[model samples]
Target chain A: MGDRAKSLRNTIVLIAGLLVFWQLMYAVIGEVAMRSPWQTMRYTVTLVETDFFWVHLTNTLQAFAVALVLSVVLGLLIGFALGLHRLSAEAMEPMLVALYSIPKITLYPIILLAFGLGMSAKIAFGAIHGIIPVALFTLNAVRSTKPILVKTGRVLKLSPPAMVRSILFPAAVPEIFTGLRVGFSLTLIGTVLGEMFAAQHGLGYLLMNAIGLYNVDVIMSVTFLLVVFAAGVNGILLAVDRRLHFRV
Target chain B: MRRVRLYQVGVIAGLLLLLEALCLAGVIDKITMPPPHRIAVDLVKLLLAGKLYPEIGKSLANVLLAFGLAYSTGIVTGTVLHGYRTARETLDPLFATYYAIPVFAFYPLFIVIFGLGDGPQVLIGFLLGVVAVIVTMLNGLDRVPRVLRKTASICRMGPFETAVHVTLPFCAPYLLTAAKLALAYAFIGVIGSEFIMARSGMGYEIGYAYTNFDNATMYPLIVLILLLSIVMNGVLTHWEKLLLARRGQR
Candidate 1:
C-alpha cells in the first residue's frame, strides 16, 4: 500500500514536471512553432469534442483493436509451437531478435504495395510491430517453465495439450502479460506510423495533415491526446504487471 | 548446431523460393513486388551505379552520431543517477513508460522547434536511444560486485578513477548490449524521421521512389536497409555471445 501511494505520487510529480518543461519550451519557442500547456489543454478538450476527431479516433481504435488481437493470437501460437520444440526455438529466437532490431518503418512501402493503402495495411503493419515481442517473451516464458512441473505432468500421463493447459499456460501467464503490455504499445505506435504514411484517415493522418497546413493547435492537441492515452493505459497495465510479478 | 543452421538456411531459402514462385505465377503482381532474384540484381545494379551513395552515407552518419551521443550521455547520466537513490526512484516511472509514448509523435514538434533538417532526425534518434542505454547501464551498475568496490576503496581511488579503472570495465558486456540497442533505436529514429519528412536520405529517397512508382529503386533500398540492420545486429549478437562465453570460462 505504501509503495503504491509512493508510485502514484511519483507519477503526479512526473506529469507536473513534464507540464512545466512543456510550458518552458513553449515560452522559448513561442506561438510560431508550438502552443503553451494551457492553450494545448484547451485545444485538446475542444478537439475531443469535435465529431471530426471522433471519426479518426474510431478508425484508429478499430485498427489498433484488430491488430492487437491478431498480434496476441499469432504471437502466442508461434511462441507456444516453437517453445514446445527445443530445436525450433533455438533456431528461431535469434532470427526473431534480428527482425525485432530492424527499423521496420522502411518496410512500410512494401506493406503499402502489398496491402494497397487502406485499413488492412495499417493493421498488418501494426501486427508486425507487435507480434515479435509477444512471441519472444512467450517463447522464453514457456521454455523456462520449471522442469519438475513438466515431469509431474508427464508422470500423470497427460497429453501435450493437457500438459500445456494445466502447467505451461499457468506458468507463463505473467511473462505473457508483460509481452502483451509491450505489444499493446508497439501496436499502437505501428498503427499510428502506418496511418502517418499512406492512409487518409486516423490521428496519425490528422497530424500529418496538420503539418502540411501548419496548424499548430491540431498538432499539439493530437500529440497531447496520443501521449495521454498511451501513457495512461501503459501505467494501468504496468501496475497490473507489477502486482502479478509480486504475487509470483 | 549444424542441423539448426541447415534448418535456418532451409527456411530462408524456402521463403525466397515461395515468393519467387508467387511472383512468377502472377499471384503477386510485378508492381507490388518483383521476384527475389530481380530485387537482388537491382540492388547490385543500384549499388554499382552509386546513385544513392550520398543518401546512404548521410543516413549512416546520422545513425552513428545518434548512437554515440546516446551511449556516452546515457552512461554518464546512469552513473550519476546511480549515486542518488531518491532521484533514480523518482525518475523510474518515466523510464518505465518512456517507450510506451510514441517518440515519433514528437518529431513534428522537433521539426517545428528546429526546422526540417538533420537536427530533428538526429534528435529523434538520440531521444529514442538514450533512455534505453541509461536503463541498461543502471542495470549493469546494480550488478557490480561489492568486492570490486572494496578493491577500489582499498586503492584509495577517486570516484572518477574507480569508474574508469574498475566499475566501467566490469560493465563492458552491458555496455555492448546497450550499444546494440542504442544503434538499433538510432536507425529506427533517423530513418523513420527521414521517411516521414526529410529533405534527403535513404528513407526519403525510398519515399520519393514509391510516390513516383519507381519500384526498381524502392525495393532495392528497402532490401539494403533490412540487410544493413540484420548484419549489424548479427555482428553485435555474435560479439555479445563471445563476451559471455569468455566470462563464463573465466
Candidate 2:
C-alpha cells in the first residue's frame, strides 16, 4: 500500500513537471511567434462562444457522422459476405489489403467529380477511406470465429440468423470494436482531407482560410478544438469498450 | 483460388475501364474526368520534362528526414520513460492527448514558427510520426520478458550494457512495427502539409492542377503520389521482415 501510494505521488509530480515544461516552452516561444498560451486560451474561448464557430463545427460534424454511418453499414455487409465463404475470402483478401494500402486520397478528384462539390462529395470520400479498415478488421474477426461454437450451434439446430446473433456476432465483437476505433480515426482524417481539398464550410475550410490569411491564432485554436473533440470521442469509445468487456 | 484472384483483379480493372469508357463516350465529360490514355500521356510528359523526379526527390527527402528525427527521439524518450514506471504513467496520457490532437490542424502555427518552407513541413511530419513510435516502444519495453532482464542482471551487466544488449533487441519487432505505422503517418502528414501550403512537392502540383481544372495533369500527380505511397509501404514491410528474421536468429 505504501509503495503504491509512493508511486502515485511520483506520477502526479511527473505530470505536474510536464505541464510546467509545456507552459515554459510556450511562454518562451509564444512571444516570438505572438502565440502565447494565454493568448491561445483567450482566442479559443472567444471563438467557441461565437455562432460562426458552431456553424462550421456543425457542418464538419454532420458530414463526419454521415460518412461514419455509411462506412460502418457498407463495411459490415461486405465483410460478412467475404468472410462467410472460403473461396471469396481467399480470392479477395489480397486485393482488399492492396486497396487498403493505397493512399485513398488520390481518389478524391474522382469522387468530387462523381458527387459534385457538396456534402455528398465529402461524405463519399470519407466513406471510401474509412470503410477499408472496417472491412479488413471484420474479415479477420469473422475468420477467427471458433469452429466449435459453430458446431455447437448446429447441434442445437439453431436457425441461420440465430447462429449469427448468438455465436458469430458475439465472438467477433472485440475485433469489430477494434476496427470501429480505427474506422473512426480514418473517418476523421478523410472528412478533414475532403474539406481541405474543396469545401465552402467546416473546420477544415476554416483552417484553410486561416492559413490563407496567415492567422496563426485562429489556426491554433481550431486545431486545439479538433484535438479536444477527437480526445473526447476516443474517451467515449474507450468507456464503451470497457463496459462491453465487463458485460461480456 | 487462382481463378478467384484473377476475378478480383478483373473487377478492379473493369471498374477502371468503365470509367475510361464513360469519359470516351462523353457521358462523364472528358474535361472533368479525362480518359486513362490522356492521364498516361500527361504522366509521360511530366516524366520527360524531368519535373517528376525532382518532386519525388524533395518529397522523399522530407519524409525520410522527418521520420529519422521522430524515430530517434521516440526511441530515446520511450527508453527513459520505460525505465521509470511512474514517469511513463504520467507521460503516457500526455502523449495520448497530443496524439489525439490532429497535428495537421496546426499547419498555420507551424508555418508561423518555421516559415512556409520545408522546415514547417518536416516539423508537422515529425509531430505525426513520433507519437506512435513512442507509444509502441513503451508498450514493447513494458512487455520485455522479466527472465531476460534477470539473466542479464545475473551476468553482472551494467545499466548501459543491459539496455544495449537486452532492451533494444527485445524491443526490435515492436520498434519495426511502429516504424511501419510511422511511415504511413509521416507520408500523410507531409502530403497533407504540401497540399495545404506547399509550392513544390507532388501535393502542391496536385493542388495546382485542381485549382486550374487541369484534370489530365492532376490525375498523373495523384497517380504518382499513390505509387510513391505503395512503393514506400512495400519497402518498409520488406525491411521489417528482414530485421525480424535477423532478430529470430538470436
Best by TM-score: 1
Superposed model 1: Cα runs more than 4 Å off: none
TM-score of each: 0.98, 0.87
Give the clashing pairs for model 2: none
Global CA lDDT computed for model 2:
0.79
Worst-scoring 10-residue span by lDDT in model 2 chain A: A29-38
Q: Give the TM-score of candidate 1.
A: 0.98
- Give the lDDT of residue A24 in candidate 2: 85
The native-contact fraction of candidate 2 is 0.42
Q: What is the TM-score of chain A alone in each candidate?
A: 0.99, 0.87
lDDT of 1 at B2: 94
CA lDDT, candidate 1, residue A74? 99
Alpha-carbon interface RMSD for all candidates, in angstroms = 0.8, 3.4
